[model samples]
Target: MQDAPRTVTFGPKRFCFGRRTYVMGVLNVTRDSFSDGGRYLAFDRAVARAEEMVEEGADIIDVGAESARLEAEKLDPAAELERLLPVIEWIARHLEVAISVDTYKSVVAEAVLQAGAHIINDISGLHEDPEMAGVVARHGAGLVVMHLQGSARQPARQPRYDDVVAEVTAYLQASIQTARQAGVAPDRIMVDPGIGVGKLTEHNLALLRELPRLKALGHPILVGHSRTSVIGNLVDAPIGDRLEGTLGATAALVALGVDVVRVHDVRANVRAARVADAILRGWTPPWPWAFDAVTGEQRRPLRSLRELARQD
Candidate 1:
């Protein structure tokens, strides 16, 4: 792990990590995503959902054209471009948030960056497409180099790590070196531990427990644990009922100093993150009137205490 710049600029947006945790809303435009697959396949529906997430306080809209499910079929570059171009163009034209194209194919990544996306979230960590790193570097897009143990086309094999944290840390360190070699600025890079991609429940838990260890790499850490099987297995709850579990885990991650959280339920997770961020980084009232009582006048509780101290 090497020290890198703490801030990254994407288009007009700059993400200054360590100040607060940024929430990235998931916008899957695929028909077979593990969760919420067909919900936003239509252009109108996808645009509307993106708008809803922006309103719900999403700092980035992660647009995925194909599912990353273990058993899912791989999408051709042309097919992926067709599914993602419209949504990415629309979001870029209509929204004020950063746009992250969740892809690993260099062609797909190049197309999306040309269509106005600001980030390329490569789950393969620059290993899948030989040209992925160059595409991101040429476009100067923010890159998310995630650590996955197996190829994306195949089902994830059960991970066999003697020490999950150490191995993951080493993988990311090497991946970061790869990205830097390909001309990606260190500040433009973020790393994901690939929580449920190739790990068992215990491995996932261990990664979460020692997430801060990855900070040694000096790139911002992005965790996407939303409604993963890790939580489902623990609570014996299905995907639909995992909201509380997701919030619980997100709150813990924020306290642990994670830089970004990718989630499905944007509104609920945004509120949970804000509260947790307030606890980890002290809260500042959004407005002075937030302290005002029901009366028309501003309450002066502290002033009253000062008067009492004078009498004493």
Candidate 2:
């Protein structure tokens, strides 16, 4: 396994991996996303949701103007920019958190990055647009090169892979090479296995089970498996009912050393990730609470003898 850099820069922010998993709240500003479409299509609602995610402890707000759902119509760059730029601009001006724009079009990426997006999450894995790498490199913005076997508009009906892990690793490696060739810094790149893009349920399960191999590529790993079909297929739950399953999968991902989890339900996932981080990354008391050794309990301070002794 290659030793990846501990920190990756996104705009003015730097994310330190292995300390605690970062949460990337998903903000799909489109009319046709698989889930939560049209909910925040309005400009006001979109900005409101972005603020809510930041307040809910999201380290990055990923704004996508187009849907990657299979059979979903492709959104042109003009229309996509119309939906995206305003939201990106609003978040950049108002929020202190990093912004990642989810797109594969170089035109859209160029505009959004110019408008203040920190990262370009190319769901196409840098395969569709030849100029995408150049645009991201020029801005020196962070990049997420996701692995999708086929086009997002019409993904393979039955995708096949002999060794899913090895193939994904190879694909991501090539994508990373593309980014490097285009002058995108190694420290500015992340990789996603593209959970629901063109993967089968079993394929998704295998990828999740063997994520350490992907981490071996030496880039921060970002997984957007929240409320996806894999969770639904496994738990037999629909889109709105997959929160518990999503949290369960998130806890597992944290244990496996994922650097960032792109999720829809930021508040619940943030709460779940804190517990997972406490257990896996070694708990640090960021709060003003004392552990009572005798009772084996945590409590707020109220003139405790130990506190007075420490003060002295």
Candidate 3:
């Protein structure tokens, strides 16, 4: 793994990467998001769902006011702010996890940050609003800069790239530079390769295969592969039925040392990530006690057969 800062502190929390993959539960409060949209549109329902996710092992709660799906109508800044403020306030006051406002508008970003959101997840990579980097900098919030080949408002055309990994890395590098120039701290920035944003299936697959290469950029890598079309297309499954595929992809990414996995099925993904992390990083049992087969007593620490034979 490339050498980078292992921890990112935002607001009152510190995210320790490398020990295990962090799960960022998706909380889209819009009625038109790709999945799980209207389910949490009401403020109370949103807060309740957020609490549910936190209990399910979500390290962060990403609240989105507007759906990022291309066909969804663009939300005005006021409407976006209005939609997000209540949920943001509730999560901020009640939840102990880090809160991220998924928005590209500088006004919404500023408003949510002041309302206790700790991060701004911009799909435009700080390019949509010229003042976005400034807003993030002013609030000293963590920033998730995702790479998209085209504008989020329009349908994404099938993008072509001579070298997809290299191109994505270059774009993120420039975006990070833009953020730094605008005064956002480097350690507080994360890069997402934009899994389903503008890329074709092959492009998304290639990015997944070459994900470890992104570590060269010296920032934490956040991959949002939860229930996206890539998985559905591969398995010929619908969005609502792609949880297994999502868990599969999430496990693969965790094995590759991804710092964070943005997901919808928080509890399932958390279990999957823990297993994958254990396999990749090695795990110790939480409790040492184990039943001894010979004695029928829970008096010995769990040990492999090889260790027992050696003791004999």
Candidate 4:
């Protein structure tokens, strides 16, 4: 795996990686997102949810107009713009957080970037729409190129991979090359493994277990596994009850040095990332904790060392 990037510029904001993991809150404005569908379909609710996420510690807001579920119906560019433009405009005008629109259509990406969005999270890895790469390049927006075995609009097919990690790495490498050829800068690109999109449970597990291999691509890795079927399969819990499972996954990703995690439960995931970052990334209390700068040990203890030894 390549050394962590020093910094990445997403539109007007700059994010320094290797300090701590960043959380991206998911805001699906569609009525069929498989998890939070219809929850933010209303304009007021969607805007409010974005505000809440920002206050809850989300470094980015990922807005999706169309659902990516295999069984979900397709949404035309016009209809998608109708649902997306207003929200993107509102977030751009009101919110201070970075805005990322989840759409594979060039028309939609163009419109959203014009509407003040900073990033485009394309599930097709710039392969779905012929004009997507150029649009992203023109806007100079941050791009996330995700790997999907089958088309996002196509019906679910059995995913076949002899070596999931090697194949995914190669697929993403090709995507990065495509972006660079289209004039998109390397620092503006991030890669996703497309967990639960076209992969079976075992495939998803393998990707997660071998995520370190993705870092070798020399791009920050972004994983969106919140409340996914993989979590449900592991914990045997329903969508609403997967909070603990999602946090568990977040901690693991933090340990693996993931740069960004796109999640539905922003507050819980942010808190989990904090603890994991503290343990794995050498983070300590910010202030008022009387910690040793060189040793990272607390100078003042709640219980005296003598008392602790007596208990032992």
lDDT (C-alpha) at residue 106 in model 3: 95
Q: How accurate is candidate 2 locally (lDDT)?
A: 0.87
Clashing pairs in 2: none
- In candidate 2, what are the lDDT values of residues 1-312, reduced to their tens digit? 223338766765667776778899999988888889889999999999998887777888999988888756688899999999999999999877889999989999999999999999999889999999999999999999999887756777889999998999999999999999999999889999999878899999999999998977888899999999999998998999999999999999888888899999998898788789788777454445466779968676555322232221
- Pairs that collide, model 3: none
- TM agreement with the true structure for every prediction: 0.90, 0.91, 0.90, 0.90
lDDT (Cα atoms) of all candidates against the true structure: 0.85, 0.87, 0.86, 0.87
Q: What is the C-alpha RMSD of each candidate to the true structure, in Å?
A: 7.1, 5.1, 6.2, 7.0
Question: Which stretches of candidate 4 lie above 4 Å from their native place?
Answer: 1-5, 285-312
At residue 279, what lDDT does model 1 achieve?
75
Clashes of 2: 0
Residues 1-312, model 1: lDDT tens digits: 222326667765577688678889999998888878889989999999998887777888999987878767689999999989999999899877899999989999988999999999988888788889998999988999898887867636777889999998998898899899999998899999998888999999999999879988888999999999998998899988999999999999888888899999988887798788777776433433324466667554433211221221
User: Cα lDDT for residue 72, model 1?
Assistant: 72
Displacement of residue 119 (Cα, Å) in model 3 is 0.6
In candidate 1, how many Å is residue 71 off?
1.7
**Residue lDDT tens for model 3, 1-312:** 423337777665577676778889999989999987689888889888998887777888999988778788789999998889999888888877899889989999999999999999999898789999999998889999999888867637768899999999999998899999999998899999999888899999999999888988888999999989899998899999999999999989987889899999998998798778778876433544477769888786655422321221
State the weakest 10-residue window (summed lDDT) of model 4: 303-312
